[model samples]
Every structure is written in C-alpha cells, then in structure tokens.
Target: MNLEDYGEGTLASAPLDVLEDYFAAHGWQSERNGDEEIVAAVKGSWTQYELRAVWRAEDRVLQFLALPDVRVPEDKRQLVYETFGLINEQLWLGHFEMWAASSMILFRHAALLDSASPAGLTLQQAETLIEAALDECERFYPVFQFVLWGDKTPQEAIAAALVDTAGEA
Candidate 1:
C-alpha cells in the first residue's frame, strides 16, 4: 500500500505492474503514481470517468472506483442518497456511493487477489468491471440530473430513466 512495498528503484508494485500493462494495451491515459495506485481517464457514453485502481497487498484486495463526470448539488444530497440506495439494490456487482467530502458519486468494486488472478486482477476481469461501471453510469446519469434539477423525486427519476425500449428511437 505504500512505497516501501515497491522497494528502492522499483517503478511500480506487483499487481499494479500488471494493471499498468492493461492500461497501456487499451491506450487509456494512465499514470502509475508511485506504486500502489494508478489513475486513468476513460470516456463513457454519458461522460468521462476518472478511474482509480488501488492494490492493497496486505489485505489481498484490489479496489476499483469509477467516478462519473457529475457533482451532486448540496440541496439534492438527500435525494441523491436515496436514489443511490435504490440503484445499489438493482446492481448485482458494484455499488454507487457518495464520497461525502466531495459529493461525488462513484461506482465501486473490489476483487480478491487470489490464485485465479495472481497479479491482483486479470485484463479480462478489468474489462468486465470497467464496462459494467460505465454502463451503469451511462444509464443512471440522466436520473441523477432529473433529481437534481428537474423537480423529480428519487423514485420518479429512477422510473423515468430505467424504462426499457424495444429498438432505436
């Protein structure tokens, strides 16, 4: 979790070394800051995401966070919280949370560094997690907007955004 794990003259940590390679292969702009963390910018349909992946060797956990390009207003914090709870209920993988200090909604997922992924995680798993995070953000972005500015309740906002369509409109 710190520079000590990386040792002198080491550019990156073990798990993050693998993740750094994954970022490079995809041509995403990423910087492995020191060792334990890598921050990348990824574009989603709805907005750009600031992707942060952290490797905690002590706990054998890889924490991933995708932050959608929106900031919740102070007045709508309560509704945003409620909508996020509903959104979390519908999600099977990662969940949405507000980083209270910034009021930024984030999609968070964690993976155990196990035998399957010796380097904390594999590229395929990373792809899946990233896609899921982006998809969820794209789908729910408008709902957040509705609650914040369109005079819609949290339930109403979710209902309006979640309706399924048959084909291209």
Candidate 2:
C-alpha cells in the first residue's frame, strides 16, 4: 500500500510508511503530521518521550529525533552541553544535541534507506532504529534530571546516574 491509500489528499510513495507500520504494530500513539514527518509519543521509565521521524527521499535518509521532554534551563545549558558530550560518547548509535533556540535536549539518529527499494524500510529495520533511540533516551534520562533539577555538575550527574547496580536492590 502507498501513502495515497491512507486517505484523500495524501500522495504516494514515502519511506515513513514503514515507521507508521511499526507504530501500529506496537500500539503506540503516532500520527503523520506531514508528508514526510511522523511523531510518536512513547512512555519510558523516567518520562514520556516524543519520537519524531522524517523521511527525506531525495537524500535517502530517515532522520529521527527522540525527546525525553525535559527542558534545560538557561543556567544549566553549559552543564547540559557537557553531559551531552559525555553521554553521546557512550552511545554506540545516535547522539545527543541541544536545541539552543528552545533549550531542549534531543537524541538524533538517521537511517540511510535504499531509495531503489520500493519497500523503502522493513519493519525490522524500523523497530531497530526507533528502539535504539529510545533505549539511549532511557539509559541517560537521569543525567538530565540530575543536572536540570538536582543542580548537579555534569561529572557528578553522569557518575551518579550511571552507577552499575548489581542484582535486585
């Protein structure tokens, strides 16, 4: 099925349909806000996350932005920036970036799709991409909470949040 089959006024042939299918299979709340963008709200251990995926067919890139929904204050921007660098270092895929305009921290990743493939993206590929972003978001969520609300230094936040607890507490 193509985009046009979804409804009237929508056009055909976009890669994000695979992403939309992923959302449907998982039963998460998501919507296609535009021809190339889909936003999904997911619940995590620490907070609600907004996952946004954009398909750029011309570039054959499906860009994803995962938001933990915590706003960084102006004063904490420097520490947040520092923590972002630290957290991103440990991430094998994707990275953290601060939107200076909105004082928002976001996790960004992208998948290079095969434009030649009519299927665009497979369901497995969609899950892998989206899950990896969310996993990163959940893993380091406390670091942001520490710096933003607890007023901890970047070093302290990372240290405290990443403590490797063994067995059941």
Top candidate by TM-score? 2
- Per-prediction TM-score to the true structure, in the order listed: 0.86, 0.88
> How well is each residue in 1-169 modelled by candidate 1, as lDDT tens digits?
3324444444325667766666788888999877689898988777889989887777877788899878888988999999989889999888999999988989899877673333546567777777787788888988988998898998999899889889887
What is residue 9's positional error in candidate 1, in angstroms? Answer: 15
Off by over 4 Å in 1: 1-12, 115-117, 167-169
**Candidate 1 clashes between residue pairs 3 or more apart in a chain or in different chains:** none
Clash count (model 1, backbone only): 0
For model 2, residues 79-160, the per-residue Cα lDDT tens digits are 8888988888888999999888888889999988765556567667787888999998998999889888998888999999
The residue pairs that clash in candidate 2, if any, are: none
| Residue 21, candidate 2: C-alpha displacement in angstroms | 1.1
